[model samples]
Target: MNSNRLPLFTRADNFVKDLTLTSNQLLLIVCAYIALILNLPFLFKSANAITGLDDFNWLFLITFPIFLFSITLLIQSLFAVKWLIKPILIITVIISTLMFYATLTYGIVFDYGMVQNTVESDSAELLSYLNLYAVVFFIVFAVIPAVLICSIKISYQPFLKELFNRITLFAGATLITVLIGTIFYSNYASVGRNNKDLIDYITPYKGIDSIYKFARKHYFYPPLKFQLLDTSPQIINKNNNKHVTVFVLGETARAQNFSLNGYNRLTNRYTANQDVISFTNISSCGTATAVSVPCMFSRLNKSNYDKRLATSQQNVIDIVHLAGTDVLWISNNNGSCKGVCTRVNTQQIATTKSNPLCDGEYCYDEALLQPLREKLHKLEYDNTLIVLHMIGSHGPTYFKRYPSNKILFTPDCQRSDIQNCTQEQLVNSYDNSIAYTDYVLNQIIIELSRLSETEDVASSMLYVSDHGESLGEKGMYLHGLPYAFAPQEQTHVPMIFWASAQVSNSTPDIDLTCLKNKSTNVFSHDMVFDAVLSITSVKSKTHHIKNDPFYGCKSASFVPLPLLESAKKIQTQSSGEH
Candidate 1:
């Protein structure tokens, strides 16, 4: 009996000794551990908060181990080759570092949009997001572990045995995960649908999924080509009064804070003094410029608009240009015009020679004025459209949007890291930027008024922001929240119209009073394309009169009045005051 027990003990000891992990297997194990640790925030915070208190503990107990085990199996299966282990470790380090930095600095969920932004961002934009804290954190958490992984010596199992073991482990993990998911389908689905951001909070997997989706959408997908709204748009110049329309595209300006929109603050003090018509309710096509700018200029409405189609097709500007109208796009903002100005003349103020308003990188919104005046002077067409893209209230450097003298709001937040500032300071700084935008728009209106008088051109100005912003509201700072889940602060923007006396006199069909009365009426970026087309008198097959705000103001037969009653009323009111 003693001899039999001794042989059994020896056999158990030999079995324990033989249970060693190869270098690739050890790397997989380390990666799995890191993935679990990185995703602990999602498991403990986002997921737990969404689950009911009664089910929270059970959910965690059931899902946590499964999540870790599943991740391990997935990674091991993908990186099964012995030589691929080092490359996998390096890739993991980079992804983990980025995830950590974004989670720590911006508190952003790593969704597909965020991933798209990451992939599309230039080196400068990417560098701006990095800092000392992020570097240190990456070194401590990601790089050090990666180095350790590379340094450790590993034992290699026989090829067949290793392959069989990997297949068995992966199969077991997948079967268990599917079984658990089936058993708790109700709870899992409820939490997943209710809290879609839960998936975004999961590390490595979140990044992996986002990259996969982005790649599939951008690379694997075939490029979609869309036909122009009109193959040949016709320009019918009514009265030929040298019509000139200035479209001021604003950035990060929310309607809620605009004094002209009934905000308590004096953010629109300058614009308020002018004869500008401000719209109270205007929703953006998207919550980010990458989506909004293209959507705003496309013939398709937000619901029907596809980014690929929008980017590929000729927009309002292009169609108007094709109709024999001179079009110019002047941009003070560093962001691209999102192909809206691709076919038209473009003037980038930041790259303009000896521009004082620019520091060779970022420029004030006022920088656009000089180039605009130059372009207006050189215009030889009977009708023209000039777009001024302003860098208004762009953050997290809100204080930089305006000049020092224009910082009307005191105790403004000066730090680029806006999260470090108090809420009051953030508001003050952001308000100052809005005030400067007011000043810039006022200056443009003054320029248009001067141009109308000097050049005998009927000038008008229309302002609409690409998207609104989130100023530390609900723990979210900056914009780019998914449109489906974005707050009102990121979708509701400001739109204003200012017509010169000459324009009003020449185009009588547009009733300013009726337009003013319609200020509180709901509008959106969808109106932009049709409104611009109507304003320029460019007739196209794609033009929808219902989408144009001024279409109803015209008389029967859709003809504009040669003289404006609104212009006469203004003159009468001015004369009475005098």
Candidate 2:
């Protein structure tokens, strides 16, 4: 800042040299800075939570220089006439926007998973971009430069000279600001108490695409080596021995919400009436359908799933197809993202179904089962593995999952946003969908039973959800909260099996009766591989028959599967064992 010598100390020189500021402008600048500081937490918290939680410190730690430099530039404009103000303001806007954009890009690269975790799992990118835009607008437009304009100091020089001076001021100010920030940060930092742990927890070790590829390759969570079970049930009394097994893969069905799993409503009455066995304490490896479906099907464990060193080998479905058992994937999901059924045949028309509860909309779970009867009629095979992916209990549109006629409980939640509704209404809508899913499963079983009567075939049905959903508990809506932070509602899913009397009694050597009375101690979506392989008699290298962690671990602890127990342990430890 330079002062020009006044011409003989006249009144005109006084007007030129003396800097003046209105009270309102000063107040506005102070208010803007205060608002920026206050709003910084919410803005940076989400980004940092995604990239690394330590980001909150930068708000106070380094913000001073950014504020000072912007204000310095702003104050310099005071010497310019009203004619030059518009150009100066435009330049300031451009520079601030570019800086904010750069900061957000850096934040996102380190913390994409947090973005993935915060956004609704379906529309993550949109949420991330929107969040960045909001943060940038506040800092650039309302915060920094506003403070500078409030101070009544001004100067004017050639454009090049001004640019050089501005650069010098920015460099000096930034260096000093950072040094002060380091001191402030050191004062506030604490061992394991600050954002350090949060930063580590959310930081992505690998790119998201790499993570996806890794998940698809490993397919198993906490992957253990291929250990085939030692025992196999002998089919000695072989009368009408042709066998047919159906594996129904349900979508987003939480076991806790299922009436069969002890919810108040009769959500699964149809299966309860039949010779169905419900395994209540089952958990999915991952929460998202994309991650969980293929992961459950893969031989790779969860820890090693994303590890570059993990082996890439044949999945359970591939083994089934190789064993000459007809394998069919009938899905309502968007093909599981990885296209786990890419090599295998899949039937999915549910995408086109209109919502029965609303006009011109697709909602009924039964829409997936529409073509099943026709497909089965065409098949001539004696042994078959039909995987039905049910669109069960996916929300915030829980009310649209089932038909209006199927709303068995009174005072139904007509709206999709269950968070705003009464808990009872939410339960009623959710349970009604489960009731409809139960009906669909029962109908498929009845068809299998009819086939068993007419043809020389053994029939059975096994149902497992990819993962569970969460209702409005602890201020969370829908599902797909980060698995570590996720409630039991999202992880604990329902697994059930229906076997005909002939097959049940003949295979009485494998006692499911104990499983019926007590929820199986060894239960997981991982066990689906062993269960299906066991059911189809595909005693191959990929199958596990005995000492299986699939269910019924001979341990004192009531926990069904060791994987679930371990995940719970990991989560507990990370949360300081709270």
Residue 192, candidate 1: how far off, in angstroms? 1.9
lDDT of 1 by residue, 1-578 (tens): 46456787676555545556576467556756666666555666554554554455565556755655576666656675777776777677677666765665555666776676556544544555455666677888778667656655557678888778778767776786777777777666777777766666777777788789888878988876555546777776557778888999999999999999889999988989897899988999988777888889986678777667677667889989999999999887666787789888898775443776765567888888788888788878988999999878877778878889888888998776677789999999999999999999999999888888897888888999988888877777778777777889989999999887765556434567777888888889989987898777776766666567877654333433432343244224323322
Query: Residue 561 error for model 1, in Å?
Result: 17
What is the C-alpha lDDT profile of model 2 across 461-540, one tens digit per residue? 88888887766665445555456556787789888877775565443223457556655565676667666666665544
Worst 10 residues of 2 by lDDT: 228-237
Note each model's CA RMSD in angstroms. Answer: 9.8, 11.9
lDDT of 1: 0.75
Best by TM-score: 1
Q: Which model scores highest in lDDT?
A: 1
Stretches off by above 4 angstroms in model 1 are 1-21, 24-29, 53-62, 65-69, 220-226, 351-354, 559-578
TM-score of each candidate? Answer: 0.86, 0.63
